[model samples]
Target chain A: MERILRIFFNNGSFFTFVGLQLLCLYLIINYNSNQAAIAAETWSIRSGKFKSALTTVNGYLDLREQNEIHRREIARLRSLLPESGYNITTEIDSIQDDSLLQRFNFLTTRIVNRSPYNPNNTLVIDRGARFSVQPGQGVMNESGLIGIVDRTTDRHARVLSILHQSTRISAGLANRGYGTLRWNGLDPRRMTLIDLPDYVPVAEGDTVYTTGFSNIFPTGQVIGTVEKTERQPGAGSLNLTVLLSNDPLRATHGYVVQDLFKEELGSLNEN
Target chain B: MRGNDAISNALRFLLILFLQVFLFRQVSLGLGGKEYLFIYLVPVFTALLPLRTPRPLVVLFSFLLGISVDLFYETLGVHAAAATFVGYARQFALGLLEPRDGYKAKSSPEGKDLGNRWWMQYLLLMVGGYCVFFFSMEAFSPVYWRDIVVKSLFTIPVSWLFCIILVTFLRPRI
Candidate 1:
């Protein structure tokens, strides 16, 4: 022990030098932009690998609840079948509408990780780049919007939860003008809708839906219902409190929405 | 004499911090829309410490100075990483550049105590190394090797000139 102590003191500078360099490496990876990107990519892939085993265990624990959700979803999808609709114009020959184009495609995947408490929380889904899951695509379930895809690896993708502070969904009253929907980073069950004109009628229990202006989601998708409304004196707009329909913490499955015409629409905005 | 040396070193640290944060930081030299040069004088603080200063103290001081400048740069750890490397390597560099008669027992590495030629060579090695390491950390990958090389090449001579000017203006007596 004495000899070891002597050696340590003798080369203290060497040890400190190595130690400090390591600290600097850590800081560089965490804070610097280029290094941070590389670090984020590595961390997502590694964490996904480690979390998969735990996710398997959790999946078994939630099997019963998941089956119930699956049943509801199947029934809902079945209701959209043409056979379920009655043709009132049986006398006239049926003609398919050529003017309408299918623009949105949905890919289903399981949510493998949940982080609802963070100021900017994120979720990890089992689908990734190989599954055509790109960043900026929206993720939703039967309830409402879960989040937008933030980053992706080969087999998994990280989603920016609606509970995150940066989340701003373009939403509006089901019958009135639109506004921006935002999370206040304080409540998981509620969000704030701003920029809606005070002239527009807003009241408790009014449903809010995505305006489809951004092309990330289809028009008329349910976001939530207004729980509270406040208009400051002399303010031109009303601030609304919305109770979210989707609880991201309870979500196990999500459909990643890909807008087929997104690039075609986005290119015009760039010009 | 030792007390005076300590006070002067402290004052030098403050001066460099001021110049770095307020003055040099605002001056940007870019070419073709890419920022190719930055005036970095903070590394000189560690490079010119007294010849006999402990290596650990040198490394710690470099880390502090780099982090202080980083606060202004809003690039938290980039400068700190480069400065720490320079500080740790300073001893090896000094050993390489030692004169036939050797350094004075109680003198800082300044142009007056050391010959201008010797000081210039030392400044070139230290500041040049700083610029290369800094840009490398900023780029953070060999994929940006061209950018790193371009930035370091444009920045080295200018940074070296600033270090020389600083050493001359603040001629530490100790």
Candidate 2:
């Protein structure tokens, strides 16, 4: 106790200096409105930034889990697609009582490889027969239609891109007229919508969509926009130059649509 | 003689404290809205304390005087904290500005005891330290560092000038 007293006496000024400054800080932070407000604001701002940084770190840490949750969410949304349901309202037809059956299921797939510049461009998708990705299933991305699935192994599938020369899409303009969408080998970004009647009042920038004439593609999926309209020398049909919306090379992910009634539709067509 | 010195020091403290809190506090040199310069004479008392005075006594005296001024300005601890720091820093400033022949016995730091050059340097240190520490404590953070720096720059020279004049007048004719 005597030694402690001697220490205090020797450095009394230093101790008092520290003690007084601490007391002043306490008073400033407690009594002064401006200082108190600044302390509170600084604390809240620091805590807010800390929380955001924590959330970002947590998000990065659980990326695989988050990806799985997002994939399930996409699957759930795909199940509710209008094209995936078949209307069963027959002789007793009422708006509220119409029954429907599930007809299509969309399986998400990542494009592993694509050859957009090839005359017969094809895309390789990750999911194949093991994931129930069958031939003739339609593939599309959020931007626009992609292509039809051509063949599948147990683990992967090949897709025939819309940029292929032989690929013909039954496209229409606002249900006013119907035409076939065909790509010329020269340009991947441009396609010709042929067989549309001139009386349909086609104009530039009109949107062309799939007409669902076949079981290949869903109804009203956007194909492209009309660039120009041309008339053959003696033909009554109008050829519309369409600027394709989907650039196949830029597409990294797509959905392969499995139509449940595809075999039945094929058998009926065969009959 | 020691009794007379104590009385004179007490009188000097009261006079500098009153002038700082009342007269100099109201003085503003700028045109309008915001004052560009501030005058602080209280730290001069701390600066001019007798060299023989203990560090703790100087600190305590400065704190009391600062809190007295803080009561008038309604800034409870800002002035007190800055004054305490200046009081603590006084030893360092005096040591740095020590005369070649050393300080005279029983003499305080004033233009009359120390040369005018030493007096000017000492006042500059004390006033500059007071302004910077006071503004920093008032702001309570370095986020307003620009305000602290600009105010200190504008206040130091002006407050130093006023302190010089005041200390010169208050200097004893021993």
Candidate 3:
């Protein structure tokens, strides 16, 4: 027993090291869905509070620029709707008109942090679950489509920015009819719209917008312009380069497009 | 003397944690690759504590440092596991370096006491072990084998170099 104690004391560090390894292994193995849900809940509350405070602190610094943006947006919206005949009460009602309201209806949010460098670049917004923000909600700045909300806490949500390699948005050329916007993970300002047929007449600088095939983003929201087009032999598809309209680095604010029928659409699809 | 030592160690740990959380967390290296680096050498505080420091105290402090970092970084339990491993290995590191006469009284393993040559050796071994353990644990699967190895190899030298520079510059004379 004395000899055993001596040996144990002699190699105390090794024993502790082994013990920690086992503990880590236990944690990894036991990492469950329930635990993750609880963690998500906790993080939601904590991050929500933190984000709210941060926004409040930084509010003064951003007020002038944000005001200018709001003014421009108001002016743009006003030019489409006359002052006398347009009913302000129908702001929510107008969303039902898929054809008429395609150019308008945006939810404003502030970008707290963003990473364009990451392969899976993500953006954090000041709005979250408490503010009706949810996963799959589409986000856009004044210029164009920004991203889709991937995760949401109570007061903060993470956006899978369009710059991310994993992002694939349904897009259509203004002149042509079909394409899908995809990132090759090379440049934040550029993405590729692939699989368009060679017969499609895609001119340089032609506008591209969301197709609204998915319920996440509304139809006709501007994405970018066709920069370059290439027709590879025997491929049967035109590879088009697109320069994104929104400068993700400079975009401090955006709006989340919450589709009111999202839940209904999801339930219908599930059945 | 002991009280002063405790105060100095606490201050050091706090400083390192502050730098890691505020400044180093934002640094990224690779453009489109999986490589990333952060200033994790703050946990080296627990590792560099005097060899005669109580084992339980060292472990507890290391655990606290790790958990604190994890809370800020959104990576739960990972930093705790790595920091604890470092704390555990610290004694072995001291044992390997100490002469037959044992560690000098009131001497910490900073560059002043350990000297440049021994300090470099000690920092490299500890930092290298930490990088391997941290990257492997983070990857946690054979699929990311290449990623884990490359990331660990790339980050260890940079992290160790930063750690050594900081220790040499800020370490008080014995």
Candidate 4:
């Protein structure tokens, strides 16, 4: 080590000579225009090759996350298929037509928790008040209506599931008189249509839809297909246990529907 | 002792630099690329530094003088590099041409002390080498190899005579 140091430095004086010469040359290269351009061009070529090699390594490490984002994207795009074309109008920002003026503006979110078997099932959703998800706004998945927003925090909201004991939506046979849609405590897929007359001509496989009486859901939104009907013991009314299209346990993503004209309609109802 | 030597050396350096930049630098004559002569007189300063100076100090001082000339001429680093090489090589040249009696400690190389023939021989060897190195650097690149040689050949005689006059007149004494 000592011999090497002595030879390298010539006991330090040689070291000083070399160091000062290098510094002067470096200053000359930096201050002179031709030398600066040559240095810059050589530096860029070397650095670009180094960076691309690093990027190849980095790109492989990030592929798992990229795949997951792609999966979510596919799910969001599938919601746009022809069967659910009306659902595309949910974008409030893109509402350029008068037909969309009174429509609910929908913002999609995921269900984080659920009590599907409970007599009054409540759902937890990922969005909250900060996302403009207010109480009374309806929630739906690709298949059909899921619930209504009951309350919210900045990051999450609780939804009152349609299967809840107090849940009611104005629904009826297509082009028929309207009644209430509700669920019994027994089954998740079956919801009942209440207060249709016993002599009503509705049958199995008949489609029930929202009647527009409740400002919460738009008219013609599918509630269910009729599974069975039975006459009430004394009221001479027909009730149904229609199979709901959206099974709460199976559906993971849903949208909170904002009623743009809710305040105006509420004031008119109060008078 | 070091302080006195440094001050005297610094003064000589300034005088040589002024003469080179203001006097000999403007003496380029000839217009059509025939019989052209460009003299460089400042290198005599490097040749006549005190005989006892350390090799490294001589090289360093010569480089500084070269850089000072470069700043004025705007050639930049060409003269400085040439001077440094000459200064470093001077000890080898002296070893080759040393007298049979050897050199005195504090004496300068002069026509009177070293004999007029020895002085003239010293000037021809050192100043001739300086002109070749300087012009080669000025016309850098192997493509201009002939130009550098021609310029140096023409420049040396004129530059050498002028440098001899300057050396005899100054007679630099500590």
Looking at candidate 4 chain A, the ten consecutive residues that score lowest on lDDT are A11-20
* TM-score (C-alpha, index-matched) for candidate 1: 0.48
- Highest lDDT: which candidate? 1
TM-score computed on alpha carbons, candidate 4: 0.43
By the TM-score metric, which is better: model 2 or model 3? 2
Evaluated at residue A62, the lDDT of candidate 3 is: 93
Q: Distance from true position, residue A109, model 3, in Å?
A: 81
Provide TM-scores for the models. Answer: 0.48, 0.55, 0.42, 0.43
Tell me how candidate 2 scores on lDDT. Answer: 0.83
The sequence of per-residue lDDT tens digits that candidate 4 reaches over residues B133-159 is: 776655444566777777877888988
> Residues B1-174, candidate 1, lDDT per residue (tens digit)?
431267777877888999999999998889778898888998788876888888888888888888888888888888988888888888888998999999888777856657899888888889987888899888876788999998888889898999888887777442
The most accurate candidate by TM-score is 2
Write the residue-wise lDDT of candidate 1 on A6-122 in tens digits.
Answer: 988877667777787788888778677778997788789889988998899888989899789789888887686556756555546546443244688889999999774778999
**How close to the true structure is residue A201 of candidate 4, measured as C-alpha lDDT?**
88
TM-score-superior candidate, 1 or 2: 2
Cα error, residue A32 of model 4, in Å, equals: 6.4
DockQ of each two-chain model: 0.37, 0.47, 0.11, 0.06
TM-score of 3: 0.42
